[model samples]
Target: MDGIHINENLMRRIVRSIDKAIADDIPQYLREHYKETNNAIIQLRGDYINENLRNLVVGGDIEFVPFKRYVWQGRIIVDRAEKITYTITTQKTLRAVPRKQRDKPHFLQTLLYIENGGYEAPVKQMTLMDLFPFEAEALENDYNSIVEGLIDPAEGYRHYVIAYDAEGSELRDVQLEFLDKDFNIIETASLNEYIKPDFARLTDVEPVDEDFNDETDGEAKGLVTIKSGLRPKLRDVQKQA
Candidate 1:
């Protein structure tokens, strides 16, 4: 039941995991396979991220569960120790907005915010329990079993949105948006600085070996050219993973 705060160190780990997936893994997969639809690409990105997070992050209190306990397609992270839960969602824009067009909250996301009183008041498990008064005990047990890492109500509930822009098969930026009771963005933290540089394509470079020794005798050997389908390198080059 501690005050809610953003753990920068933990956030860094999440950012690094995402950076590797979107920048290195996905692009390479696309290069090696046929093109995928936008929806399929989104799912692939989420799977790669969750897999990376499970591997790179170490913690017993962290749990991956579907948002609202039923939306498997919208899986999210629940950190019991931190008393904060967040979901990594995608957006076309660099900034993550709660609403569809920046004016209204998405229906599913709104349900979560409303259930927590939109941060205006502390959430109470009793309030939820009261709804199923006829079968409180049984329902509580079921809910507990379903939500393995429910945030302690006494600690109060805090929700954050981790939004990333991965348009055009490249990650343009990543950010954390803090929201108030009205779903307005109260603050933001950009994690782009922590993202590793983009991977560079090795193209048209001659081999380091100067001599190509062969039984061809005096036959001349021309320079060998290596071809790649990846785009040219930018000024800030990233090491291949």
Candidate 2:
């Protein structure tokens, strides 16, 4: 892999587009569907952003690719020149940003480690390997043979989590995290804090439970659930490097 490279100017443009979606699209959607449950609201918000991000008008050679294959499918923003693919995910946060992964790992989540962090030696793999080895093996076997044709094959991947408050009224934070081969978060950035340096870190936030699971959403702690033969198992089309 060529390694992850961040283009600050392009990142700013992408972040601004997401901000607009949160500020404009979300409120409009909420107004239309006011009686939805909290979990339903989460899905609604995610679907709205996922759909609108494709229509985002961030100029230059950057492109957004939508993968409609698996259950973990979503759109990935790509900077052709930089050869970096940005994976977007949404989460509800007690703090300003998402600090933990799901109780059960998703295939795309696993691919993020392989891309940003490299599928190197065992001692270098992400901490998830030790936490959920059985599920990891299942996910690894389910990886498909398909590949997304790109102008330039991606060298690395970046994760962008759009975290919202529990009430779903506001976007608590938007974070860009860089990971190393050891699965440790090496750096973090947020456009909100970038534009305004004193953007309230929310240190008074409640302590987070690392084993967070939503009974309402029916996400239980077990083997990684995969919708295997239903779709051509695509581990990550963007990780061509």
Q: For this target, which candidate reaches the highest lDDT against the unseen true structure? A: 1
Per residue, candidate 1 scores C-alpha lDDT tens digits across 1-241 of 2223666656766777776666566767766775444335535666677777666543555555653333434445666665566767654421223222422234223423433444542332223212322233443444344444444434654666677765444566788766543444556678787665544222211221212221111001111121223334542343332
Best by TM-score: 1
lDDT by residue for model 2 (1-241), tens: 3333446655444554454444445655556656535334434444555555544422355566655444534556655545555655543221211234555444345444445444333233335445544354544433322124442224444443333221233344566655443444555556454321112211112222323221111011111111111111111322332
The CA lDDT of each predicted structure is 0.49, 0.41
Model 1: per-residue Cα lDDT at residue 135: 34
Error of 2 at 8 (Å): 3.0
Name the 10 consecutive residues with the lowest summed lDDT in model 2.
Answer: 215-224
